[model samples]
Target: SQQGEEDPQALSIQEGENATMNCSYKTSINNLQWYRQNSGRGLVHLILIRSNEREKHSGRLRVTLDTSKKSSSLLITASRAADTASYFCAVLYMEYGNKLVFGAGTILRVKS
Candidate 1:
């Protein structure tokens, strides 16, 4: 079974705005990671927050995790046309070793 599922299947926003995406999981996790993928390309690692960490930030990206609720959110600040991509949340199941289960992802379009 898929451990994580992202909300807002699709989103459209203008440049310079902020885009927020959410994910919910079905099981306990050791850690959760966010990834970004451009059109027709492989995914790039964005950020990872441990089950014990409430939040983390990298560059223009911010991620928050709530293990108690089995949920997480990703925020992209100052959105740009190049930021248009699909965002995914992957969960590292606590009982599944190092395997990461990925969500369906949220397609974000940033119009300039």
Candidate 2:
């Protein structure tokens, strides 16, 4: 199985709008996570959904996982200009414990 990949390389929207990013993987995973990265900085974990779980939410962010399809999605509601950043989806490889693979990520820009 391969790592995850995000669709729509980039997105631009106005504040208060919603942003959705999709991630697809090729292998079985123990868990899936979403992260946010500011320009020239480290990433911050947004949410994590276990393989057995179908969905999870944190604040204004929502995440869903489909183990059968080996896919996941991240949705940000009422996005603010501060949400402008790159979002990535990571998967915990079941074959290799402690190994986490990250997707290329989707760049989102929210204009005020």
Candidate 3:
């Protein structure tokens, strides 16, 4: 079962702006990964934060995980039109044999 669910199913932003998307999960997770997918294209790995970590960053992307709240948020700074895509949060459950479950995703549209 998919453990994560992203909020604000859709978002629209202007270029150079910042976009934030959040995800909430039901059970515990060993790690949480965020991915981006262009229309009709495969998902691209964005960033991942381990259970022991509170936050992780890569380039203009930042991810924060809160095991106590069972939630996470992804922040994209200085967004560009190229950043337009669907963002998904995948949860890896250690107890489930490291099974990864993905949320429905949040559609992001960055306009120039």
TM-score versus the correct structure, for each prediction: 0.96, 0.95, 0.96
Q: How far is 102's C-alpha from truth in model 3 (Å)?
A: 0.1
lDDT of each: 0.94, 0.92, 0.93
Residue lDDT tens for model 3, 1-112:
5568898899999999999999999787889999999999999999989999999999999999999999999999999999999999999987788789999999999999
Per residue, candidate 1 scores C-alpha lDDT tens digits across 1-112 of: 7658899999999999999999999888889999999999999999999999999999999999988889999999999999999999999998888899999999999999
The candidate with the higher lDDT, 1 or 2, is 1
lDDT of 1 at 101: 95
Ranking by lDDT: 1, 3, 2
Q: Candidate 3 has which clashing residue pairs, if any?
A: none
* Residue-level lDDT for 92 in candidate 1: 95
Which one is best on TM-score?
A: 1
Where is the poorest 10-residue window by lDDT in model 3? 1-10
* Candidate 2 C-alpha error for residue 21, in Å: 0.3
- Clash count in backbone of candidate 1: 0
